[model samples]
Each structure stands twice: as C-alpha cells, then as structure tokens.
Target: MATYDLIVVGAGALGAFHAYHAAKAGQRVLLLEKDQYPIGATVRNFGQVVPSGLAGRWFEYGRRSLEIYRDIQSQTDLTVRANGTVYIASDSDEWVLANELYDRYQAIGYPCELLSKLQCLTKYPLLQPDYVVGGLFFPDELSVEPEQMIHRLIAFAQKKYGVDYRPGSVVVDCQSNYGGAILTLANKQRFQAGRVLICSGHEVRLLFPEQLADAGLVVSKLQMLLVEPVAGVTLPGNMLTGLTIRRYESFQECPSYASIPKPEHLAELQKWGIHILFKQAIDGSFIVGDSHEYADATKAEDLGFHTQDYINQLMLTEARRIVTFPLEVRKTWAGFYSQTKAEIFEYDVDENIRIITGIGGKGMSSGAGYAEASIREMGL
Candidate 1:
C-alpha cells in the first residue's frame, strides 16, 4: 500500500507550504527535512512578506499569502505580524520615481500612501532626517519572525491536520516503484507515496542536477546580518530606501524608473545588485544586507561555504548611509537559494514525481499562495 498520499522533500517555506496545503485538503502527507529543522534561505533572509513590492501575478500571489498568513495566525496562534513597508526616497531622481510609482499604484487602487518629507519624519521619528525626501508606505504588507516561523508553522500543520513530519532524515534516492514513488533515505530507509514533490531549494544538486541545469538554474548567494537596536529604539515598520527602488522588480513599473539615470553612487549600488531592506523583530531588533552573486549551475558545485568579507562590508556601509539607527551586529550569515530567469519553475520527471522550486526572493512573500495554486493545478 502507498503509505502516504504525498511525500514532500525539503522543509523550507516551499516544501512546508506544500505539505501544509496537501494535508489541509485531507491527504496523508509526509514532509521530509535533512536537518533537525529547516535552516535554509527560509530562515536566513528578511521575512518581509511585501505584496506591494511584487508585480503582476506574483503580486496577486503575495496578496493571497497575506490572507493565508492571517488565517493561520488566527487558526493556529502562529506569529504573522502586520508591520507594513516604508520605501524612502532620498534624492530628486528617487523622489520622481516614487511619485510615478505612487500614481500607478493609485490607478490600480493599491493601498499605498506617498508621504512628504515632513510626513515621513512625523510618522517615523527614527528615520535619519537628513536622508529623508519623500516616501511610499504600503499599508498592506506584513512580516514574520523568520527564525521561528517555519518551525511553528510546521508544528501547527502537524497538530491541526496530522501531517507526518520527519526531521533529520535525508532522502538520498527517489524513483518510481510499484505504481507509486519510493524515496530512499541516507540510512537505506524507504518510504512510498502516490505523489512526490521535490522542493529542495538550491540543493538541486541532490536530485535533478541535470534537469536544473537545463532549466538555467543559478545559485543566488546573499550576505545578510541581524542587529540589535540601541536600547529602547523602535522602528515604525519594514524600512527600504532609494537603493531598493532599483532592486525590487515592482518598482520597474514606474515610467520614471526607466528614464531616470542612476547617479554614480546609486549606480554603483546597482552594479553590485545590493538590496538594503530592513524588517524589525518583535523584540525591537532589526534584520537587514543582501548582496546578490549569481553562480552558473555548472559552477554551483564550487559554490562553497564562504561569505565575502568585502561584500559584507559594502552592505553594512551602504546600510549606514540610508538610516541612522545604532545597529550593533548581533548575528550575521549567508543565505543561498535557487533562481531562474523563468517566472515559475516546476516540472515532472514522471507522472508521479514532480519538482517545484525557484521563486527566488519571493519564497516568503508569495510561497503559500503559489503552493496552493500549484497543488490545485497538479491535482495531487
């Protein structure tokens, strides 16, 4: 007998959400994670679930994620906070870009406010006054405590729907067997399921290295850090500055975004693909770098355990220029995730085994809804 209706590999946000939705729909689901718990890009990056910064179908997916997160919080008592997002414009060009984005947002009836310099300062006293020009505040965005989020969500899914979650067991081989799928663990243990999904993040090297290469999969390495605020300092919400306007794809919708030439410094920030965003924790600490480096899948094997010191320095240096918070580095780490030029990445090796991954930085922002829709379409 097929022991489980579905066996989902990887316990990151993507895998967890797949397990969640399948189990919620009354299937016998098993979620497998190699480590004791998920510690991949899911937990390592800023957990700012910002729909306002997403464009097209992804923005809709992010909106659905907001509702799902809210529902989970109410149903399971998990921590999904409504912190919102503030994108600041520090110069004329950036200010012009913000206005264009604001106009387009107003046309679409998106709930965003374009605040004047005085309004920004009045609302967020912690913002460095000298760096403020004007800003856009997206009132609908939300955030999650990343470090604790995945674990709690999986726990809730387990308790509410009887999801069989197995941690510390790594899948070494998976193949079709006996009209179903059989996954072999590192310890030679085997499990069967009618359907199997591999949501293994950038670690595609494990199952489908050849296929991932064909799909143009690349590894995006990011340098990130967490810092404690000066005693009693409080941030108004998730913070972004001019640097982000160029990085987030959603901002490209503004006509000015295309016409405005990047200033030397901003151009330099763009050259390295640095995205400086901030999300404040419930304890008042802040999560903040994110410098992007893309490695071809062929060289992804050489992609090693290294955090570029110069890149980290560049990130912290730029962060200081945007805001004046006394950010003492409490913890820092590098995060890795898979990305492709494709908007969505998923395929099937056979009818029974499917691969779903590579939504890039939107994993936390758009993952839940994407998973829900993909599962429905897969009919699994």
Candidate 2:
C-alpha cells in the first residue's frame, strides 16, 4: 500500500491549491478527482478575481489569493490576466452606494479610482451613455479563462512540485485507523494517508450524508451565457453594473446601504437574484450572466439540469437596457455550488479526516489563499 502525508479528494480549485501548498511545504501529497477533468464551479464560473466585491476576512483572503495567483503565473502560464474591474452606476441611489463603498475601501487603504460619467463612457464605448452615470475601478483585479486555467495549474504542480495527481479515481470509502486514514477506491484499491481533506464541492452525500444533512448547506444554481464575438468591439476588464452595485456584498456593508430604497419595480429580478456582469475573453467573445436559485443541499435535484429560457430572457432584457452591443447568445448553461450561513463549511470528522466545501461563488476569488491559511491552521 502506498502512503502519503496528505490525501486531497476533489481536484477543484480549493483542493488543487491545498495540494500545491502542501507539496510546496515538502509534504508528500496525493490529489484525486472523480471526473477525467474538473467540470464544477471552478470551471463553470465567470473567472473574475475581484476582491472588491467581497467583505471582511473573505476580502483579505481574496487579496492574498491575487498575490498567490500572480506568483504561480510568474513561474508558469496559468491564464492569469491583470485586466482590472469596474462597477458602473446608472442612477442616484446606485451612485451613492458606489461612493460609499469607495470610502470603505479607501479607509482600508485599498486602491481604487472613482470615474466620472465622461470617464466611464470614454473607457467603455460599448456602454450606453444614458445607462452609466459614473463608475468605480479596481486596477489590481484579474480575469482568467476558466476552462484552461485549472488544467494548466494541475500540470504545473505535477512537473514543478512533484504532487501526484490521479483523475477518474472515485473514492468510495474512507476509514480512519490508529495514526492515519485508509481510502478505498471504487475498484477496491486502497491507499493510506496521515490525513484526508475532502473539498469535493456538492458531492458530500457520498462520503458523509448525516453530517451534510445537518450542516445547513444550500445548493445554488446559476444561469450564465456567452455572447458570440462582436466585431469592432472591445471590453478589456470586468464590467459590473448598477444591478451589481445594488446586489454585491461589499455594497451591503456600506453605511448608506440600508437607507437606499430598493426599487419596487425590480421585484421579479430580485426574486430570481439576477445581476449583470460582463468580461471580454481574449478571443473577443463576452461572458455575461447570471442569476441565483437555491434549494437545500439534499434537494439539489429540485433545481433541474435544464436552463430556464424565461430567466435567460429576463437577463437579456436587462442586459439590453444596459449595453448597446449586440448579444446573440452562443450558449447558455446552469452551474451549481454549495454554501452555508457561515462564510464556509468546515467540519472535522476526526483528527485524521476533515470535510471542507460550500464556498459559494467566492471559490475563484478566494480559494487559493484560504487553502494556504487552512493548511497552516491544520498544522499539515
């Protein structure tokens, strides 16, 4: 039987980074994935690393994650791009929230630029002039090609750090022994490890159903679409709008957030949790999305696999109101992720086994830094 210092189940962003850090710390690490490649929230995301959208420790974690991502990119190509992020305001209420959040970021010494109406129009010509009142821009953020980034990161870790990575290896059982845990694969092959970390996303029912049922986790289904590349149009960075200004967590933390009246007309949009954001890919196509729908983790099936056309049209309707550019949908799909009332769900089944999942949308922005911190906290 082969033995390892750490066995990380699920090679998504969280698990892969944990394995990378463990190996970087000189521990023998094994990374396992059920599918031939990662096809979860890690890849099915907007790939926007905007710390500006988060608050508190998550915001700090996101800031650190940016640093870690750049460090890795320096060593190899991880599809990391420093294109920056901007939040555009359409009305006085949203405009107030933007300024308030700017003050909050300023107090913390984070760098951001407040743009005038003309500045916003000058920077992004595709934006409808009347739709944009002003904007706030964060220059240190990034946008990545989600489909390509994870594969490159895994390959880099294998070649440079000597981390053992196995795909299509499904773990059926994990039992703790005297000093370590034994992991049994679907084929009945077994491996031993000093500790096992499960960052398996929403697939927790397979390993520990009782804990997952009582963990208060909810699965969120999001709908996003890709626009076919538009000729003579260029959007360089993450473009967040008025709806986003009203919906993001950072804005909720602002002092004026409570007093700002919610528009009664937007009730249906709020019911579905729709927020419009745009990011132009290197290939000139635009990635736009998304709306949130929730169900208990146990009832994830309630949120079916089919994408809702009415929901997509609601998004496209609002999207058209915001931008003049053509939005011919190239593709549409649903992405699932888990979350809890707490920032993350971390349960220690025993000293040798821990289950960590339910990071919500913060995975892309904060996963790397949180994993590094978790390793030190675990003394692994």
Candidate 3:
C-alpha cells in the first residue's frame, strides 16, 4: 500500500485541524475516526471563539485562530458568526478587572471596546441592569454551532484539500517504524503514513496508555443547558457575566486581579466552579452553561456519567440573576475534555509518532492556530 504523508487519528477539532493544515500544505493526509461523527468535547461545547478569555501563547493562538476561522467561513459555511463577546461586570471589583483587562488589550494593540452601563444595556437588552455595571467587549470574536461547524469543516477539507477521511473506522493498533507508523483498523485492514498524530481527546487507553497515565492529564467534566427559545429575546454574541469576568484566564493577567476581593456571597459558585455565560442559537434558543469538575485522566470515571441536578440548578439560579428573559431548561448534558497544568499535552513516541491532546476549553479557540504551528514545526 502507498504510504501517506500524514495520518491523523480522531477527527475531532484538534485532529481535523491538524489534518486541514497538513493537507492545505500539499501533504497527502489520511484522517480516521472511530465514530460515525465527532461527538466529543468538540461538538459538545459553547462554540464561543473568545480569545479575550485566554492569556499567553494560547491568547496568541486564539487570535490566529480567529483569522483562520474567518477565512474558512469566507470559503464555505462553517456556522461561524462574528457577533462578538462581552464580559459584563456585576460589581466594582469585577468591573475593575474588566477595565484592567481592557487596558491590557489596548497595550497589545488588540481592538476592544469599553462599554458604559447604558451602552451595554442598549446593545444587549436582555441583560439585567442591576446585575451589569460596565462591560469589556471584543467585537472580533465569533460564535459557532459546534456540531454544524465541525461536520462542515470536515466536508470542506475533504473537497478543497483532497483529504482522505474515514469515519466509523476504529483504529485497533498503532506501531511506529523508522520510516513512519502503521495503523491497524478493527477490521484487520492497515494503513501507513510517514507521520502519525493522535489527537484523540480524552480517550487514551487504546494506544499508549502508559505514556498517558503519567502525562499529567486530567479530565474535566462540564455541565451545560439549553434554554427553550424565548420569543423576541435577542442576546447578541457571547454574554459573559461577573462570575466569568472573575474566572477567565485573561482577567488574571490584569495587575489588580490578584488583589480583587472575592465576593463571599458567591462562595457556593466558587465551590462548584460555575460561570454563567449565554449564547443564542440560530433557532433563537439560549445555550447556557457551565460548571467545571475534574479527575485524573486514568480515573475520569470519578467525574461520573450522571448529570447533577444541583449543578444545573446552581447554573440556572446564577443565569436568571444575570438576564431578564425566562430560562426554562429544555435540555442539559455533560461534556468531557482533558486538560493539564500546562497549556496542552504533547508527547512524542518516536520521530514519526506524536500525541497531542488535553487542550481543555481552548480547543475551539486555539485548535486551528495551534495545529497550524504544530504542522509547520513537524515540517509536514
């Protein structure tokens, strides 16, 4: 059989982006997925591409991803909409962080708008006036329907870049040689590639369990809800609240962040890691979420499979406090993603085999840009 230039395992956002970049660079690529479609963290996310929430290299990656996403949208429909992102501060302390973050972005020459309480109310009528003081807005950010975007992206890559995409093909084995790597499917069929990149999200036991067990990866379980479409309620873009302003990594970069006094009243929210955010779907329903719960990758089961009603209640209680529109939870589910203390997990099994996963919530924000850099670094 002919050896391809690259083989990407797992056609999720991370893997698909890596394949996209390599194929775009004129490399022969093979993309494989065990499932009929990507249904992991890639599709089960808020789909908010808010680089404003990131810091350091990831911030840079997110910025680049914005361009890549916009470029792709220009080519075909990826469900990408440039509506923007806003962080509405509820109190003086959170407002302080918002202003500081705005100033930080200004210094870096990134475009951002500082909105007055009146401007915020005018722009987003659903926000509760009492709950919002002032806001920091990034007009360049985007929102996507995760399921639609990933599927469309795969199709676009296949048509435009000539990528060989095989879905529902389970990879049973991976072995590396000096020339490249070999992958065996569950049906006993095999394929060869000059290099193999595993972007398998949180499922690590299939290939290199030993390397991953000690890779310092932790699986984060996030709970989210979908509110039934409230008629005539238009909450534009990504509506992030005081809790999000206080929790996002970008706010931590501000000089005043370290000293901002925590609100004792929100102790329970802190305990549950709840951050209230709202995004309107094309059908007019509001997508609301989410709370973070974690366990070591090897013990991801500890995070549990059942949805905790208490967590959903906590999120709804907080969301109702921020928006005026009625929130009748229509659906709720849990999303799993892997994360480490570092930005992302990268391991090399040999010269031709590499493992990249554990991007956390930054996958949609930074995956394209990071994968581009990764492909270039590998000289693919």
Candidate 4:
C-alpha cells in the first residue's frame, strides 16, 4: 500500500489549496480527483477575488490569499490578473450604500474609494454614463484564469514540493485505522495516510453519507455564463453590482447596511439578485453569472440554462449603465457548490480521519487561507 502523510479528495479550489499547503509544509501529500481536470465550481464562475465581499475574518484571509497569489505567480507560471475591482451603483440609493461601505472599508484600512458616475466614466471610458450613479473601487482585488490557475498550482505542488496527484481516481471507500485512514480507490487500490482531509465539495456526502446527515450540508446548483468581449472595449477591471453588497456578509455586517433602502433591499432578496460580478479572461472574453438553486440530488438534466439567460439579461441591463459594450453569448453552464448552514463544516469522523467542506460560494476567494488553517488544525 502507498503511504503518505495526508490524502486530499477533490481537486477543486479548496482541495488544491490544501494540497499546496500540505506539500509546502514538507508532508507527503496525495491529491486525488475523479475528473481528468477540475469540472466543478472552481472553474465554472467568474474568477474575481474580492476581499470586499467576504466577512471581516474572511476578508483578512482573502488579503493574505491575494499576497500568496501575487508571490506564487513569480514562483510558478500561473497567469495572475491583478486588475482590481469596481463596485458600480445604479441608483442614488445604491450610491449612498456604496459611500457607506467605502467609508467602513477605509476605516478598517482596506484600500477602497468612492467615485462619482462621472469619475468612473472618466477613469474607464468603456463605462456607460446612464447606468452608474457612483462606484466603489478596490485597488487590491485581482482575478485569474481558473483552469490555468488550478493546473499551475497542481504542477507547482508536484514539481516543486513533491506532492503526488492521482487524477481520474475515484475514492470508493474510506476506512479509519488507529494511526490514519485507508482510502480505497475505484480500482481497488488502497492508500494509507496519517490524515485525510475531505475538501470534496458536494461529493463529501457521498464519501461519508451517514456522518453528514446531521451537519445540514446540502448541494447548491449555480448557473453561469460566458460572453464574447467587445473588440475595442476592455473593462478597466472586475465589476460588482450593488445587490452583491446586500448579500455579502462583509457589507451586511457593516454599519453601512443602515444606508441601504428598505424597499430596494426587499426587492433584491425577492429576486435573489445579489450583485453581478464580471471578470475578463486573458483572451478578453468575459465570464458572467450567477444564480443559485438548492437541491439534495443534483443531476445533469436538472441543470438550468434559462436561469443563466435571466442573470445575463440582468447583468447586461446593469452593464449598459456602466459600459457600452455589445456582448454576445458564448457559452452557458452550471456547477455545484456545497452549502452548509454553518460558516464552515469541519468534523472528525474518526480520530485520524477529518472532513473539511462548506466554503459556500466563496471558495476561490478564501479557500487558500482555510486550507492553511485546516492543515494546522490537523497538525500536518
């Protein structure tokens, strides 16, 4: 049997981050994934890394993650797009809310600025004047091409840190032993590890069905889309809508929430219209999204494309207010994110076996920090 210090299931954002940290710590790590490449939530949505959307604690982690991302780019060949982010407000009320958030974030020493609609248009000529009343700009935010980022992270872990990866290997069974856990692969191959961290998002339940029953961890399906970018018009940076502020804990927890109009807040929740975040790929194509739908058993046929259309329309309407680019639909898809009632779900199924999941939808932004914390907790 192959033996290692740690075994990580799922090669998504959380899994990759955990594997990277474990190998960096000089632990023998094995990362197993059922797919040939990551086809999960990791690569399915906008790749914006917004520190502003996270809670205060997570925002701090995001700041650290951004630093790691910045340093890793020079060490690895991953394409890190650190263009920053702009939160656009469509109405006077939203502008008020944006100013309030800007003040709060600035008070916490976060780099953010409140800009008038005219200032935003002057700064980014592609912006449409009528759509934006004001904007919040975060100079430290960045984005990456999700596929390239994951591949590069995995390559760095293996080549530089000696992390072993078993792609296309599905873990069929897990048995806990005294010192560690034994994982049975689909091919009947067994691997032993001193510790096992289950970063496998929605697949966590399938691996430990009985244990997760009491955890209230369920699956949420999110629909997303990609749009062909306009030839001459390039977004100055990433963009977020005002609705996002209402949904994100960072904004909701802030005293700025008092500035948001009650009727507007209710309307947003009724439509589930959190802010729309947009990021342009290296090729200049923009990835847009997303709407959430929760379910216990999510199947291929159950995925919705019309939901993407609805979200796209909403985004375009908002985008028209900020920029004058003609967008053409390129592709639409859906991905599954694990949802837990709690902020994070960590449990010890056995003394040497641990499960870590429930990053919600903030995996890309906060996964690295959580992975580091998880590793420390495991003493690996």
What TM-score does candidate 3 get on C-alpha atoms?
Answer: 0.99
TM-scores of all predicted structures? 0.95, 0.99, 0.99, 0.92
Better of 3 and 4 by lDDT: 3
| Cα lDDT for residue 317, candidate 1 | 84
- Taking all chains together, the TM-score of candidate 4 against the true structure is 0.92
Residue 233 of candidate 2: its Cα lDDT? 95
Whole-model Cα lDDT per candidate?
Answer: 0.85, 0.92, 0.92, 0.77
TM-score of 2: 0.99
lDDT of 3 by residue, 75-144 (tens): 9999999999999999999989988888889999889999999999999988888898999999999999
Model 2 segments beyond 4 Å from truth? none
Candidate 4 residue-wise lDDT, 267-345, digit = tens: 6433744356677888888876666666553342354434655655665565555457776779877777777777878
Candidate 1, TM-score vs. the true structure? 0.95
Backbone clash numbers for all candidates listed: 0, 0, 0, 6
* Residue 25 displacement (Å), model 2: 0.9
lDDT of 4 at 67: 83
Candidate 1 lDDT over residue span 1-380, tens digit each = 33899999999999999999999999999999999999888998888888877888898888899889998999875568886889998888888888888888888787899999999988887778888999999887888888899999999999998989999989989899776899999998889999999998887677877887687777887788888867757775688888887767888887777787767876656766787888888888888877787887557656576877777777788788767777688877888888888876788999899998777888999999989997888786
Best model per lDDT: 3
Q: Can you give the lDDT of residue 163 in candidate 4?
A: 90
Ranking by lDDT: 3, 2, 1, 4
